[model samples]
Target: MKEYIVTKHAIQRAVERLGQTEQHAPHHLKQLMQTAFYQGETPGPNGFIRKFYDHFKTKTRLVVIGEKIITVYKFPEAVPIPFADEVAQVIKRKFAKSERDFKRKERALSIEIAEFNVELAQHRLSYAKAKSPKVRESLSDKISELETKVGRIQFELDEAIKAFNAIKEGAAKYL
Candidate 1:
């Protein structure tokens, strides 16, 4: 329902680029401008609003400033880049492998840490029940060693998780 002032330049461009006759250019341009507005416009450089309309097998790009139609021209078709699909597939595979490796390492480290915790618990129980100070000290040493091993494995798991997250973030840019 908004009014638009169709400029002579816009009519001229439609006549030249869209093959419309000079007599009919204004009407045709007005119709295309309406269609473009209905479809919505994207903000262009230098305060221009750019819109596109496909009519009778022709794709037209309309440029406007405020409510004035500035220019009308054909929208160019995109050309496909060579090997783009192959490159995408390769990148996807690399990220998948990295994710799987991280998960596998995490699972293994988690299992090892769990086992060490069970051993530590058993050593603590034995230390509590033992009468001799020597036996209790020995059990205490074993518990400390197991705890150290568990800490080291947990650190490795954390590092693997960090590395996997970095790879995931890097892969997002490409895919």
Candidate 2:
């Protein structure tokens, strides 16, 4: 793994440009620098590298020389992108919609499981109160069937939740 060192001057510059306090600047700057070093694209020549970061709604640029962060400053102007922002917005909306759909499905499955449990409980009560053996046997079968339904629905809910979590993890990188 490549390690990039964050200098005191870079931290101070990030604190000033990004409106972060001195106390929290070092850690935050280090994290941002590390992320930039790994994830950010270098826009300049091989010897010169610039990393653009958005911090506190302010676009900033970090100057890195080899393994040392030389300084950080507010970006003077917007980086030109004709349709990249629009495409990103569309992709974000799609992710949001998928997340909402998964949540809705999970809720629906949970409600269904609860309703099955309630029906099972009612059947159990009926079984206990019945006097005839025929009715008791029938109720016992019904309760077993309801329990199976509940178990199946519960498994589905668990799978849906796992899928939702996976989507969230995948979306975090972009959003």
Candidate 1, residue 101: Cα displacement in angstroms equals: 1.6
lDDT of 1 by residue, 75-149 (tens): 676788799899999999999998888888888889999999998899999998999999988998998899899
TM-score of 1: 0.55
What is candidate 2's lDDT per residue for 127-155, written digit by digit as tens?
Answer: 99999999999999999999999989998
Cα-based lDDT at residue 126, candidate 1: 95
Distance from true position, residue 46, model 2, in Å?
23
Give the number of the best model, judged by TM-score: 1
Off by over 4 Å in 1: 1-81
lDDT of 1: 0.82
TM-score per candidate, chains pooled: 0.55, 0.51
Clashes of 2: 0
Give the Cα-based TM-score of candidate 2 against the true structure: 0.51
